[model samples]
Target: MAHRRPATGRVSTLSEAKASSRAARSRQLCRSRRKAVSCSGAAARQSCSRATWTWSDYALEEAGRLTHPLRYDAETDHFVPIAWDEAFERAGAALRSVADPNQVEFYTSGRASNEAAFLYQLFAREFGTNNFPDCSNMCHEATSVGLPKSIGVGKGTVTLEDFDETDAVFSFGHNPGTNHPRMLGTLREVSRRGKPIIAINPLRERGLERFQDPQAPVEMVTLGATPISSAYHLIKVGGDLALLKGMMKALFEADALDMAAGGAGLLDREFIHMHTSGIDALRADIDATDWDAICRVSGLSRDAIESIARGYWTAPRAIFCYGMGITQHRHGTETVQQMANLLLLRGNFGREGAGICPVRGHSNVQGDRTVGITEIPTEHFLERLDRAFGITSPRAHGHNAVEAIAAMRDGTAKAFIGLGGNLAVAISDPQTTFPAFRKLDLSVQIVTKLNRTCLLTARESLVLPCLGRTEIDVQASGRQAVTVEDSMSVVHASRGMLKPVSDTLRSEPAIVAGLARAAVPNSVVAWDELVADYDRIRDKIEEVFPDFYDFNERVRVKGGFRLRVGASQRQWDTPDGLAHFLVTELPLDVEREGHPYLLTTIRSHDQYNTTIYGLNDRYRGITGRRDVVFLNADDLRELGLEHGDRVDIVAGERELRGQTAVAHDIARGSIAAYYPEANGLIALDEHDHASGTPSYKSTPVRVRRAA
Candidate 1:
């Protein structure tokens, strides 16, 4: 039996030490067994062993080095370790020999720092191509494209402080416990304060249900988890747009009732009159939408929708937060706009606690876009950049991730340079994407770990290993702390604590500098000097973008500083002086589906993007393997399948001709499969027309028992 310990924050007691040991022993026991068992049953047996495992042991396990480091192989599939200098020279020559500037493409990942990202974009633009495909294209392109039309900016309006003061929190399509552990603390505090957290998702997530913060002393000691969501509404997948529209419709009806009762302060009439346009058109659309149609489409009854609207009306301030689940749909851009429309009805933007929050996946995805990693080139940014750097930045519009992949497969793109990210695993249509990668004249990757992308070798492939976020980066000028912008646009300094795993490992910035120096021999900037001290790079950034003025000094502050967003102050950056309202027509196929189901990809609790930490997904009651899919019990019964029975999902599209995935537990009609695994089933060109973001959420598919 495990002994109870004190909730004193520190793990010091002898019983606590003993409990951790037992937990490890149990895990070892489970691993030693060959047959598959229930994860809950495994947990029950391991509970005694878990108490014996220390936090350090868990950390070490997560930080284990790759047994086989990726290297360049000239002959077979096996990678042979080569010198860094040799790889760089070969990569530079291959890139330089490329015939056309448009033939080369550069990809950026969210893990890259602002300085490295800025330098990467500069290098690509100066190289005479605007083909800067980034990770943002896959995640929050909807928010980036939608929010500007609604609130004048692409970023979330609220800060960490706003979570404390808000009366209500509305979370849509995001699981804070696994994706962002820091957010769990905020939600727990809100739950403790008796504030309602309304969660709208198709599947009930464990993190949203109850979260046991490993950092919390009392919770950790008691093994108790705090309940997060006050109300959980399981809406049908791809029905978010209809659901949001229904909510707005309910709000309008409620506002009408308040007006009839002679209430003057029910709606923000002044804000609508002064700051917005197309109110009449929006009102007409809401009035035209029948409650029954809304209810049927959204998978919610009229009373239930009304109840949620009343909660919104009752709360003084509310924060609307969404994740990739909202942004990966076919109508993702319009869905985001609907969210904005709901917020605008209450005048949520430009306020302290009430605003839009698009929970970004990666650390610096937003920052990378801000620095100029864009397919759509802004003339103002380019003109300013050219003047600052004394080099002509590409002005022509270029390809996004999908477009780049298409170009590569079609033999239009000859060279591929990824600063960081697992392009092969992250992209859709691996069958075509892998073949395209192999066709590259030069394929250069700046990576930290061994991934599937590194295996797609080109005629001239090079892998430059870099320091991880947790690893110390020492240079000629001494130690350096990299700056990363969070989901809220808060740029903060992250100084590494651990030493580099390998002596040959280089900093991302240093590696970029070396490549830039080798590729462009007559370059004006002192690449080595800038790499020595990152402050110089920041200085260069300040020179290029005036918005980042005094970058070094400002980053020295504790939480760093917020980048100025002109839209927050009611400054419109659109073509017109005012925000434009564009009408979107929902596709008939999506609206009138007879199957009554929509599929969406999800990240497991033990995963981050494409990185598979482990097979067990503790939140969704899935364990041992990642092959199983989550499903509704009714849907399963209707299909004549059991929990453990395997089924093949064939996406109903010609482009996905040979794409079929086998999985189990997915909600009936509705299916939840892991991303990249399901990515191939989604067509390449099937994306949001406005933003060019692939429709990862709403893939129409037929499920059948596997042979």
Candidate 2:
């Protein structure tokens, strides 16, 4: 077999390759560092030892330094470091001074542990507000909101073990190689079994096409990469919902044909009758949609759609996995529900090697939300929480990320306490988000690294450095293990081996506990004691959530345990006590008016979420630049533009506005741009009303030559 070589055309031993990669990475870092120092107009070769600096010294100096998380700073910004006791008093005073509990919002990041998140929510609820706007609101909120209506569970149903028995794996709108590298091992195993892996995305990612496992001896020695995508389809941006509907339509048609030929076992007639509803409505909708519309929107031919659907139907068991791509659209919630509907039609739920999987971006994002980081407060959960902590929990609904920013901008919200997150930089419409931060009476941030959010300083702002996941967290008791929940809803323990970067830093749990102790006078629960021993925190968790019964003991068992998902067991937790089907009216306009193209934001392979590891997007054949945009070859011809031509993209209606032009390999009638940079073009109000998630994937824009 003839093997393909990388563009560099140089092959070496695995060790040598790794060394070269590291060296190149190091050189880039050094150059960036030097440029940063030069830009700051400071002495490039200053010695920090002259200032008697400690690890925390650097953090203290850079606390409110950089204007934005993505920008560089020239001079160190000094902050008056206060004593721990003084900090506690200030925090408590700030909380007490708040005129209304509704005015204060508690923000959580994916970096928060289960214990800290639970405590943070408890403290906020007890403080008289349930305004827990977590990181999930910006990312996978659609999945959490959509899945329940479709199949009865918000979390993915398949366990890691199910991958072993999968006959076919369908992945969409996610890049696993960079976002979750651990999943590559599972993909490799599935490939070894000769199972077909289908990938549907606008970009042809290298990991989806081929991957070389550094841990494999045979593949490493042979200098080979495994082929991942048996069938790769480049669907147009925002076309996933249509593509999914088309596939289901094909499957239903195929099932009818099979039945006409006297095949009774082809479809799960029994399961459909017992476990689902609204099949007739779904069938009618699929029948009404024409083939031409599906093909044009999906950028796939009728034959291609049929072929993929045929393969899916032939498989005894399959798993459908998706990422932000499916959840960042105008119809993000509908997209997720369609995925659930696809699974349900085939009896995919409650079975081995079958289910819907929404790959979470952050390690502990799902866990934080599970432990009470939510805008919508549940009555039963709060009542149980009140019993456990001996405090009256607030029942008032609070703001999500979008509403929180709106509140702050309008002076409705006065104080903001971020448990862990880059709120100002992460939210849409920075023009409003940054100013809202400045308007806050008190802005408290507990973080591990420096980010732009810290620079949006309040009149009385404090930056408390905290421990990173890679660092050891030691409290008064001893070393500790923080717990997190995976995409599949399995709760597990994570213990850090690396030493703390700074002695002044505190654990997330400890920071939350410190604030709780200060804010709540004569608190019944021992905040400090819970921080010392995480098991006690889990005991409280078990009391509130019945699924976590025997939490401490169960977590000790190697894989941990899965939280109960009623949907997987054929139990619908909906208002009607049945899985309901929602009908979405498709837009008549196939393409954006006047503009010959559509635009979507994508992540580079070297990046994870908002963190850019390097400039190179190995999958897209790009190197050393993020400003470049992607365009389809046919679209380029249609627009009378060549490769690297500057094109402006205009987004927003009459009020909100933005425009950017860049050179980019995106599909015809579609354009691709990097996030955070493009995020400014989107408005805060432009989100799913039901889920409150930003429409990051499908932003209608007009493209033309830049003046």
TM-scores for every candidate against the unseen true structure: 0.88, 0.88
lDDT of 1 by residue, 576-599 (tens): 645544444433466334445577
* Candidate 2 lDDT, 1-707, residue by residue in tens: 21222323121224345644654655554444333322223432231222312212122223222111121121434343455677777878988898898999799988888988998998888788988778899889999898877876688888888899889999988878877688888888898899999998887677777779999998999999898889998888888888888898899888888889888745677888877788899889989999898888877888988888887889999899899988887788988888887877888888888888898988889998888888886788888988988999877789999999999999999888998778776777777888898898888888754455765767666767677777888877788888999988899888889987556667788878888888888778778778888888999999998889999999989988899887667777887677666666554443667644556777777665655556566566655555556767677667776555545667744212222223333455677788766777678887877788887777777656655
TM-score of 2: 0.88
What is the clash count of model 1?
22
User: Of the candidates shown, which would achieve the greatest lDDT relative to the real structure?
Assistant: 2
CA lDDT of each prediction against the hidden true structure: 0.74, 0.75
Instruction: Give stretches of model 2 more than 4 Å off.
Output: 1-78, 575-577, 587-591, 653-665
Which residue pairs clash within candidate 2?
40-74, 629-663, 629-664, 630-664, 630-665, 630-666, 631-665, 631-666, 632-666
* Residue 534 shift from truth in candidate 1, angstroms: 0.5
Q: Cα lDDT for residue 300, model 1?
A: 74
